[model samples]
Target: MITIILICIGVLFNIFGCVGLIRLPDVYNRLQAATKCVTLGCCSILLGVVFHYGLSDAGFKALFAIPILFFSATVAAHALIRGAYHFGTKLGEKSVKDDYKEVVK
Candidate 1:
């Protein structure tokens, strides 16, 4: 029931992330989509596993994995984007403003 719903939601997020990777114009945007969607999707899937398994060892492992996945994904994405920006990766033509430009300078 709820487990199935959560799994479905996670799958949808993963699908959207894949589509974003294909559709986005630049590395930064692609990284943003991949990081956010994939992190949420993985967390949701793990939560579904926890729900299905109760508080057993597997469930406990899933619970512990959630926060680790979230934080690591966010941090890694930020680092990658920052590195790309510093290395002179240009934004897409449609990009309006670089809020980081002033901060980085």
Candidate 2:
């Protein structure tokens, strides 16, 4: 029951992430959406696996994978966004402010 609910939530988040990737105006926004939604989705799916499997081998693996997935996804997304900014990717027209501009100068 709970496992099904978690899996459904995960699926919804993943769908939202995909939509964000297609709908967002700029690379940064897309990256933010992809990173946050996908990470949460994956983690939720893994949590469901853990719940479904209890203390079995699959559950143990999911337990170990959760933190690793979270941290790595966040770090990877930050690195990609930073790299894109350094490489001269422009912000979208709707973007209000760049917090990094003064820092880069």
Candidate 3:
């Protein structure tokens, strides 16, 4: 029951992330949406797996993967966004703030 709920929530989050990717105006915004939402969604699904399998091997794997996915996804997104910015990718028109603009040379 709980597992199903968690999985359903995770699936919804994943769907939101996909939608964000399609609808966002620029690469930076799209990447932010994809990274945060999808990472959280996957982590939730993995938590569901842990609840379902308890102390089994599959559950342990899922447990370990949660942190790896979270950290790796965030780090990778930051790196990609930084690279894109350095390569001269511009932000969306509606974007109001750019902390990086002042910091990065």
Best by lDDT: 2
Ordered by TM-score, highest first, the candidates read 2, 3, 1
- Decide which is better by lDDT, 2 or 3: 2
lDDT of 1 by residue, 1-105 (tens): 999999999999999999999999999899988998999999999999999999999999999999999889989998998899999899999999878888775
Encode model 2's per-residue lDDT on 27-94: one tens digit a residue. Answer: 99999899999999999999999999999999999999999998899899989999998898989999
The models' CA-based lDDT, in order, is: 0.93, 0.94, 0.93
Clashing pairs in 2: none
Worst 10 residues of 1 by lDDT: 96-105
Backbone clashes in model 1: 0
Q: Work out the TM-score per prediction.
A: 0.92, 0.93, 0.92
User: What's each prediction's clash count?
Assistant: 0, 0, 0
Error of 2 at 22 (Å): 0.5
How does candidate 3 score on lDDT? 0.93
- The TM-score, computed over Cα atoms with residue i paired to residue i, of candidate 3 is 0.92
